[model samples]
Target: MSQSIIAKRYADALFQLGKERSKLDQFETELLTLREVYRDNNKIVSFLKHPRVSVDQKKKVMTDSFQSFSEEIVNTLKLLVERHREDIIADMIQHYIGMMNDAKGIADADVYSVRELSEAEKQRLSETFAPKVGKQSLNLTNIVDSSILGGIRLRVGNRIFDGSVSGKLRRIERELVSTNKR
Candidate 1:
């Protein structure tokens, strides 16, 4: 009933279907693309989740939206709509991708920097972070965020190491206040 459970169920079903049909990679890609579409476009999401709209209408929109995508993904979206499982759309796709990566023995990495990191810097960071991950191989993604002020925030799976200037400032402020109180 919960979104998490629905996502897990849909992800498992999709993973099994993908594995059996030997199209897991394609399916994963399509799913990820569709998930991004949903994330970036608020209108499409509102249409699907709108209580007034019929499932058939939503399915049509989904099919039209993903016209260029693979039949597997389009059909899967249709099935999800038909089953009233739209809530799990994003989570299922993400979870399915994770499963596919695991199957290929690859790990996902995310590095957030205050500014665009140079290729050499990225490579060095990857080299430093990748080896620490228990995953066989790592796929590192760089994200630039000016709000960090300075430094990098490396996230490998669920673990996050915050090395940003904001984080440092907060730690320093905390220590300062604590010392002042003492």
Candidate 2:
């Protein structure tokens, strides 16, 4: 099976277990932390993937590193190590988080602006855009992007609502070119 398919299956199983234990929120939090650690530390993954490392050593390392994490997450990491599927850890965590977010009616969004958005602006954007995306609310991450020039560009999932000045200019340019072609 494909890596994504395997990851999704693991995520689904973890999600079901989380629901059964009434620990979905906690598991989500732990998964997020694991994602962050994996992102920031390449050495950890490298160490786990090293051919010289024994499965027992890898499992011990994972358990020791994440002793504070819940048993479910720790066991999952150990299982991944044992199976030599460390590469899918990040994808699995992401899928699990996505499942949790869907259950909570929340969507993660990136709002790109020329400057850092104020809390009020973020709240207003969340309010205006959440319903349009069929989500109760958005967990907005503001990205200061000078390339947008002005206005804001909001991205939720694969959809991008581009209201930036540069985006508008590009749209107009496209229209003009298409009109000229005709």
Best candidate according to TM-score: 2
How high is the lDDT of residue 126 in model 2?
94
lDDT of each: 0.84, 0.95
Clashes of each: 0, 0
lDDT of 2 by residue, 1-182 (tens): 99999999999999999999999989999999999999999999899889999999999999999999999999999998889899999999989988988998999999999999999999999999999999999999999999989999999999999999999999999999999999
The estimated TM-scores of all candidates read: 0.74, 0.90
Question: Whole-model lDDT, candidate 1?
Answer: 0.84
**Which residue runs does candidate 1 get wrong by more than 4 Å?**
112-115, 141-153, 160-182
lDDT of 2 at 156: 99
Worst 10 residues of 1 by lDDT: 129-138
